[model samples]
Target chain A: MTSFGNEPLFLGIDGGGSKCRAVLYRKDSGIIGEGLAGPANPVQGLERAQDAVLACASAALSDAGLSQSQLGHLIVGAGLAGVNAPRTRAAMLSWQHPFAQFYLTTDLHIASLGAHDGTDGAVIITGTGSSGFSQCAGQQRFLGGHGFPLGDKAGGAWLGLAAVQAALLALDNLGPATSLSQAVLAKTHSQDSTALMDQFCGQPSAPYGQLAALVFDEAAKGDAVAKAIVADGAGYLSNMVLQLTELGPIKVAFIGGLGGIWQPWLSDAAKARITPALQGPEVGAVIYAQQRYTGEHAP
Target chain B: MTSFGNEPLFLGIDGGGSKCRAVLYRKDSGIIGEGLAGPANPVQGLERAQDAVLACASAALSDAGLSQSQLGHLIVGAGLAGVNAPRTRAAMLSWQHPFAQFYLTTDLHIASLGAHDGTDGAVIITGTGSSGFSQCAGQQRFLGGHGFPLGDKAGGAWLGLAAVQAALLALDNLGPATSLSQAVLAKTHSQDSTALMDQFCGQPSAPYGQLAALVFDEAAKGDAVAKAIVADGAGYLSNMVLQLTELGPIKVAFIGGLGGIWQPWLSDAAKARITPALQGPEVGAVIYAQQRYTGEHAP
Candidate 1:
């Protein structure tokens, strides 16, 4: 009935901190349909991530002009955020997903695959969080991306956090009173240190990530503290990029919301090895499904 | 009726991150009994804090050989952690407490009160958390103690967090590898960065605070990174002490579990300003109750 006989439908999903993206594909027709949903990182919430995956899958099927029952006919590849944690990965693996076949991996892995278009390469993601992954010579290496507060250096959340820290120290007269501090105070609409601190107490990284742009804005205006923060972050990313490059002569693709902003700040050597991503992570997920499915069914 | 003519029994409570402490006192007999209970920081949990307060109060009454119904006869003073946040304070104040009268203030306030023996002075608390409070010339000033991952420099949690960050950087080869990193890995039983990060993910400040001694231990052995961390924290505290002293000619007392460990690290000027607290915070709570009660009943 389909364009090609005995060809299976492939569903690729990229689940991240804020949203989940899905693509329904067939070998004969490329991507037939796509769908989107919200907050599918298992580290944030396991049940919520699972629900988003199923919902996006169904939506993708519907968008492809197919019935919901076609979900069971689709082979799926999912790249989810927070699955690197052993416990989170286990919880996800226990999921009774609705699909003919399922393959799961880290969001970084999918991003890398898609960046190089299923070839060997490295990807540096600088969104709400930061991390690097490289697959070369049949080996994979992970760098940075330890999560917020503990790590995730050069990330949006880290930039915002550094700005807040500088502001608080200046407010207490323990650190220099820079324009960056004033900028942070103005951005948060906080009249004083107490108000500023209160706004961020017990908060997750998303709220901090929201403040990251302020740091860059102030730095561009030649704020010393802001510049220092940016330099430190960029230095970390440069080091990460260099380390990822050590896994061979693989091209490193800087991707994510803040990726473009960080590009110029990298070292000249790091910049030299940079390349544009071939496709989005959602497409990488599909490639993952196809590879795994073929590997399993091979003679 | 009880001892001195018509004098009421005073119950003083110091509610903190890990435990609640209570002291029962009377005009004729000072500190007749004391009791301790579990964690009572309202920022951590509202109902749990309330329950800990009640439990500690009940235990104090029992220790003083009084019946549970005696809860209604005692005037209470509670100095709780996190009450500096208006929301946490409002929630705590709304408790339907079983006491003849309830007086509430921040733990820092009572610490300052008790440290100076109800006189004008300053107190810096460096424990599982950190804060500075000074009462002088009919005015009160609050400093630092912004809570973990935000502020609280020189606090145990801050020290531990800095160590972890250093260790992670070293493991990633982004920073110089020091004995501090080796010690942290051994302490956490982690073979690499992933395990170290895993142990601290989504963890509260208390767990990090537990690792603080490792920093001090390594610093004592002349580890450059550990020493730098200590110096940075001490510098912040030194500045805080100088600011508190600027309020007036006030004696500053370093208080809390880690207070003594940090004392020798402070600047000579900060050291010169330091004095020993005359009493613990629980006793300070009683002083707070008496001061409030006398003020209310006067004229």
Candidate 2:
């Protein structure tokens, strides 16, 4: 049998479209190390994520003074890029990794686990993408956020995409004039649609999601356009929660940028519609690592 | 070089999930034919739609007294079950029959075209499913509606799916006490959740969308839960419109069962953001047919 590492650290990761993170737990079940890096989207294109995951993991591992062979039962529960899809899954599964006993899944699933402290609950994850997942009696179900150009309505990408449309509409004098143009202009320092196009097209890596926040902020300040988006996003989320809870009793949690913005206004609404138990993915990862790696009673 | 049908009989057909139609065009260059059928999901299990199309077209043709060869050009455009995607595109393209020339596209694309004569416009088709499409400057773009389990957020299926959840939530006392219980009771003619469950689980022909409509109608009459759903649906449509207009100046049009119900209330607000264009697929097909079979008249 394999032995534990030098003081052996268990690991968990929340690998997302924009970022990937790793959190280390102690042999005795306490938090030890943490590291963050750029996107590890193992499905779309795995090279970057593979390199990044390995490098990030090593950075965290190096910080903990442990080598790959030193660990026992790594139990890396990753929220991978395309876990719901077999092609993505197959690609990710084929990722050239040397991990020992690695467990991979969607980021939303891990967020669900993290949000409910590894218990029965549902989580709506909205980043560049959006997804809803629930677990009860060890059964899991997912709703929405299929992929880009098709699904993932009411997420950061959805909001960002809306902002782009609003900008285009205003440029063409198609819709009611709004400040989105100014916000995008300021964001890109561009004079007209041509410059804006360059930023989206040419790219020093423009943050497409940056505009989603502007829309939310503008909506909060009473722009009808923005208000429509918030109202729509809440509905998208509510719809997701409704589907997730179809299985059985459970709490609900929100994760991602839009969640952070809508949380206060939505808290009461959520209480009426969902159960109360909730938390975050980072904390959830810690708890998961403890239960799966360090013995439950290990001190 | 081609002769027109003397009776001025024209037919317009909109086929997809939840509703399918064969409306004859009778007025000079306008719609006159009319027939409705079941789900003609081309991506679904079989060849029923091809037969349905031929039968319905024949019926319309008979009504008009237009022989096959004498007809100017029987331009047939279809947005069927399997046409929304790239993989299905080849299959859809290959389904040509004798019609001078036939055009096949996604129900989403054709619906958008039908709504506004295939101009730069968008359509939120919310029948048994929901999807959005926008075409501008001779290019097509799509958003939402990946599939059923991955249903577009804020759609008929989403609404139908949400109503079921609310009813279930009330069953376990996990949510507010609402009339959904009574609504469920009224639909299945059962007193409690058990009877409803029997229908819900029975043979899968319960028309779950019917329950979603009850939620919308009650909301119109001031039911709290129902009102939320109506506003929620309106909000989602707004977001979809925004995304569709991303390509360029787009006049959005709504279609499908839930779209019809919600269109009136949503019109002013929707028009505020999108230039709401009125027309449907039948009109679009005629317009597309004119361009394809005869000379360039601009679509």
Candidate with best TM-score: 1
Q: How good is chain A of candidate 1, measured by TM-score? A: 0.95
Writing each residue's lDDT as its tens digit, candidate 1 over A1-299 gives 12333458999999998899999998878999899998799988999999999999988887888878787788999999878778899999999887888799999999999999999999999998899999999889888888889989989999998899899999988789999999889989999998999899778898899889999988898999999999999889888888888989899999999999998888898898899999999999999998899999898
Give a tens-digit lDDT track for model 2, residues B1-299: 23474433334455665456665554455554455666666655336666666666766665555554533345565556556545556755676565555666666666676677656677777765566778889888666554432234456655665665556545534345677656756765766444444455312222565676777767767767766766766766676677677778767777766666767656364656444446667566555554454453244
The TM-scores of all predictions, comma-separated, are 0.91, 0.48
Once superposed on the true structure, which residue ranges of model 1 sit more than 4 Å away at CA? A1-4, A42-51, A67-73, A84-100, A293-299, B1-5, B38-55, B66-75, B84-101, B292-299
Per-residue lDDT value at B53 in model 2: 65
lDDT of 2 by residue, A116-233 (tens): 7777788777776666778888788766654432245666756765666556545534455677666767766877654554455312112566667887878877887777777877
The true-structure Cα RMSD of candidate 1 reads: 2.9
Predicted candidate 1 versus true structure: per-residue lDDT over B5-66, tens digit per residue? 34688999999888999999988778887889999999889999999989999898888877
- Docking class for model 2 is incorrect
For residue B269, give model 1's deviation from the true position in Å.
2.4
